[model samples]
Target: MLWAHGSRVSRLPKDRCSGITPPDKMPTRAPWQALSVVLILLWGHPRATLACPHPCACYVPSEVHCTFRSLASVPAGISKHVERINLGFNSIQALSETSFAGLTKLELLMIHGNDIPSIPDGALRDLTSLQVFKFSYNKLRVITGQTLQGLWNLMRLHVDHNKIEFIHPQAFSGLTSLRLVHLEGNMLQQLHPATFSTFSFLDYFRLSTVRHLYLAENRMRTLPAGMLQNMPLLENLYLHGNPWSCDCEMRWFLEWDAKSKGKNSQCDSWMPSPYRSGNIPFSSMPVLLCLGSA
Candidate 1:
């Protein structure tokens, strides 16, 4: 009788089969819940690459049009493959660093008519392949160093038709691969010498190729000295339409004009009259010697 009772006890239910619960023990089936929490955290990063559907413009599949939207801040839901962005005709007043964090493959950013009062430093640090940047026709009073830090593959930059009064020193310090710069129709009071300094890769660029610079039709009295220093064989210079300040301070421009053989700049009918020599337009000379500052 004892042996039969012992065998019955051994055949009884195991812990899993038993529905009975021990009050002292906690539940153990919560591993899957913990794994779900980890997944949620991983996909929530702002810089993570995503795929968003394209709108009307066919040229840029990953591109988003925030135009005429009066968007005061950066747009969200950008895909990873976005190469060109057109935020023109918007009212974007400000931008942050990670505003473009989701677009790792971005190449061009166009912000033509926005009243962007300021662009924070390192605004484009990660965008190395950016080719053309346009900020034409806006209310830009000043450009800060924080605005331009890491745009290594930048080829063309246009900042024309605006209220740009000054360009901060070291503002264009890290822009080494820049080929063309357009600064026309602005409210510039003073020009800086470091405005057009090139730092790397000078040989592959053709002498006929454009390190082309356009400083035309604005409030420039005279260009800062040695502004074009160390620049080798620059092509297509257009500095006409400015009120040339013909003075002793404007003599260096004359010297550079003589050495350039008329390709580095175009100054015609600038000085009043060289024969009389009071304050002729600097354009008249092979290097025009204007009498007073513009």
Candidate 2:
């Protein structure tokens, strides 16, 4: 016999059941009724077992998925155990300091296709365990230094398809474990030397773990010498679709491209050595006219 939720439920011993009980000795319907009550009391209360948030589905373990909600802000009352949060295709404009404060177990955060114009400081300070963060297709213009602080364990970041024009030098300072960074399809005009370098004990060092760097479809003309130095693990570098200035200043980049041995590093506007001396290659360059003028 076992007592469940103040209800005494009787159980027959295995030795007493030899295979089948005689019709006269069989249990009555009253005992079966008691067993039904015990079963209902044990599994009837679903709210007590898992408190899933409204407009969101929380599956076993920890995963919250909410999309196309048109939510103007981060949904409140999210369970702390949620590991992944998909809030894409919403109307969120900005992120406050306390938007995602207590979610220490968060790993993947996708907030793409929103109207976020800017990211305030400490907006993601509490997401320490975050690994992949996607903020693509937003209206962001600039990335400040403190916008992504405290994300030490972050690995992949996707901020492409935005109108980003400027990135603070220290925007990616604390992201030591970052591996892939996607900044394509933006309006970036230049990159500072310290934009990707960090000060170490005695000298500056770039993120060595960064393997893939996507900077295509931007407005950049040239990169300063040693701007991408010390990235020993860098493999895939996408620098195409930009108006590359094939001048003396791009000697380092051209040399590096030639030495890449077809390792998926792309660049354009490279003239042969014979034509480098005041010779212009008009046939090799592609022209793009304005929208109204021919």
Candidate 3:
């Protein structure tokens, strides 16, 4: 009889044991076979044995946490099944085209808390399934055309807290599904009319899907006439902390903005009169409390 303790016992009586096999004569499992069985039970499942990268944490198969690692570039050996990648709190300076090349299933990519100065063309070319792209708290100075081209499914873009000075006329032309844009805390001097011209599309009539625009804390002097005419779905516009020149050139904008969206636009201060009026000093522009509309 096979005992539960891995030992064999004789079940036959002594009189019948003449033809019965002895307990010690039974076949025994080899030591290596028992060890192999133990190894198979420990590592037989792929998920239980998948190795995570060094200095990084992969608590699950779909999420990776590589924060505060001081990584200079994108790390390798990340499983392609990963859906969310958090690379925040690093010293990554530049992003090349192949940085995220094979990460097809990546959905949420967080590269904030870095020192990226400029984003090259096709830098984010492979993130087709990416929905949220954050590049905040960087040293980006300019946003040229094609700098943000291949993001079709992008919804929320946070480019705030940078030194962006000049945005190319067609910099934001390809964000068709974009809903929120945060451009506050930058050095934007002017917002060209063509900057948002490509955002309009034909649904039944011309329409825009952009809902919120945050341009606060910049150096905007005056906005072009009819700049927000195409944004049919615009709900909130934050334009405070800018030196707005309130004059005859702003008459149409003021009237249109006031009538279009009641109290949606705002500004810090406005000049009561036109600039260079009788060689008037720029400091003479009155600082009055007026919403930045029109």
Candidate 4:
């Protein structure tokens, strides 16, 4: 008889004389041998419980943490059932379309703090169920129209702290559900009028659902007229930390700001010092003392 310890089987009994079978009468194999073979085969089969990839830890059933792993690319064998994946603080340089091909149930993807320079078209199209995507602190230089396609359900996006210099007019085409966007700390100098506008039948009244927009810490000197017209639902707009020039080109914004502040007095508190200067013409302010000129 064999003794059992937890899930392991102990050694066989030392008594060899008891219940011994004659050599001529013994069967070719023990009766339990076939049963053991079946058990081994079943245990070796791939299943959900054994799907976690190497070096990454799955502390919960639906979340996978691969942060700080020094990974060069997305790891293979990620379970399709996983809902959240944290790939932050890795050395990943690029993402292929197949990186997350079958992960349709994925909702949150954190790939911040990497060296990715650009996202290929359709690379993230498979993430239809994704709600939150964090790609900040990367090396992206531009956002193309197809870079963010098929993310119909995405709500919040963090693309701040990159080197983005331009964004295609249709880059945000299908992101109708977006609520917040971060574009701060980049190299942007200008923006197209339709950069944030979605296609609408009323040509002059295109709109976006975004409530909070972060455009601080960039190189923009003046905003084009009607840029903010597309963001009717905007609640908070961060424009600090840019080299804003108080010139005739910004007259429309000053008028809009005054009108908006007249209706919503509380919004004045969110304005930078130069914008909050009451009853003073923006051009009268010394060019050297303009807000964000530092």
Candidate 5:
């Protein structure tokens, strides 16, 4: 019997539960089990939780989609482990050098449908592992030589539907792995011979590796001689929707067009009288009189 604060309490008999162990004689947890608990608390669970960026959904471990968010600029705190980033349909006007500084694992970057006017030199130098880049439907006016310095592994580039007026001679110097280039719907009037060729002092040239090239709907009247001769692996060429001057400067293109075995080499121009609604092939149409003798 035990005496309480204001009443007396009765105790149970010692033979009530003879199988039960006393409090001091109970066995303790093994040392290995206690060590595992401590390790789990320090390292967390196996499926570790990810800290996603605000206002952007991270559904997978490698991709981050931030499209149509009305974002004026690129958001901060993006994970470096991400491989792909989609920032399309935004109002981003500019990109700094540190925009993608430490994201070495990034492969695909899509920043199209924005209002970018120009890119500073070395702004994209950190994207060493980049493969595909899309910059269409923007307000770019020129492509400087240093604008695309460090994209060594880039394959496909889309810069169409912009306001590009000029491209420097060495604008595509280090892009040896480039396969496709889309430059349609721009305001380009001319192209340098060295734009796609690397000249050596021994009077030889190394051609580019581009396969598909699009230069449609531009303001080019004539292309420099030997422009297409450098692209040996070119499969598709789009040069329609331009007022071509059928003169001696264009006679080489006509001869090359007849002998080339490319799949799609469209160089048609829109006619008015009989072919108003359709485009006539440059080789079949004799109505385009030569402005000068070839």
Candidate 6:
């Protein structure tokens, strides 16, 4: 007689073995085998887990923790009821259209702390409900018009600390809801003139704002004198800690900035401003754009 413990015993007397016919005669399951089969069906499979809960899974119901997981690639779909998905601290290199296949209801997706060099085309095409998109601390060096397509509802974007060198002029055309952008630390050496030509609702005023406008740590040695003609609403300009070559090229900034101002034409000209005091003009304190004394 075969028992469920992986062992078998000899048949007993006829009284005990009454039901024991040939091995293939009856349905062939012993009493223990019947119980074993029932137990197998009762218990589910083993517990296997992905790095985090799918956005459609348990995350939408509440705040989910997907931090510090070493996931190299993304799995398939998420749960239909999930909402906030945090997938930070991974080695994710690229973003494909197939990565996030079914997260339609996802709102906040924290994809910071990864190795993403650049976002691919249509990476986030159908996620209609995405709100806050975070992609900080990566190796991203470029931004294209197609880098951000389907995130029509995105509000706050944090791509501050990265290796971004420049943004395609049309990159911000489709992002209508962008209020404040943080691009403090980057490799942005310069900006393109056609930058805001396609700005959907973005203010057309500050032309420098398109350069991530960080002049404090400017890598550019000189400012194109006449480039400021197109921008008018510039309130604050930081040109500190930069190597500036005082010459006629920057003279355009003086001439064009004066012409761009449609209001109060007498306050001060970009040429006679205080930014030029210590750098070039030592006689006065009018914010003049000049060569740094030090």
- Candidate number with greatest lDDT: 4
Quantify how close model 2 is to the true structure by its C-alpha RMSD in Å: 11.3
Residue 131 error for model 1, in Å? 1.1
Model 1 C-alpha lDDT per residue in residues 1-294, reported as the tens digit of each score? 111474474444465446655656868658888888877876785334444433324344656666676777767667766788888987788888787775557788888998887666767777777888888887877887657677767888888887888887556666777788787888776776655554524433212122778777777777788666656747657777776665566678777777775743543224445444443444564333332323
The digit string of per-residue lDDT tens for model 2 on 182-288 reads 99999998987667643343444454567888999898878878776756677888877776665556657656666664554444543454433332332222221
Clashing pairs in model 5, backbone N/Cα/C closer than 3 A: none
Clashing pairs counted in every model? 16, 0, 4, 0, 0, 18
Q: Candidate 6's error at 63, in angstroms?
A: 4.6
Q: Encode model 5's per-residue lDDT on 1-294: one tens digit a residue.
A: 222455757665667557677778877777778999888876674224344576777888677888998887788877777789999999999888788888777899999999999988888888889999999999999999888778888899999999999999878876888899999999999998767543323446657778898999999878998878877878888888776654446768878888887444445443344444344455643435452222
Q: Write the candidate numbers in order of decreasing lDDT.
A: 4, 5, 2, 3, 1, 6
Better of 4 and 6 by lDDT: 4
How many clashes show up in model 3?
4
Superposition error at 47 for model 1 (Å)? 16
Of the pair 1 and 2, which is ahead by lDDT? Answer: 2
Model 2 TM-score, all chains together: 0.72
lDDT of 3 by residue, 34-97 (tens): 9999889877664565557777898887888999999998787776667788988899988877
> Candidate 1, residue 108: CA error in Å?
1.0
What do the candidate models score in CA lDDT, each in turn? 0.67, 0.76, 0.73, 0.80, 0.78, 0.58
Q: TM-scores for all candidates?
A: 0.68, 0.72, 0.72, 0.74, 0.77, 0.56
The TM-score of candidate 3 is 0.72
Clashes of 4: 0
Cα deviation of 74, candidate 3, in Å:
1.9
Leading candidate by TM-score: 5
Candidate 3 clashing pairs? Answer: 253-294, 254-294, 266-292, 267-292
Supply the TM-score for candidate 6. 0.56
Compared with the true structure, what per-residue lDDT tens digits does model 6 show for residues 1-294?
Answer: 443434756555567666667756766458889899877865543222223354323432444556766767664444444467777888878777777756677688888899999888777776668778888888888888777778777666677678887788777566555444555466666666544332334555433233223334435555543344433334434455444444444555445445542333221213334343334431222233234431
TM-score of 1: 0.68
Q: State the local distance difference test value for candidate 4.
A: 0.80
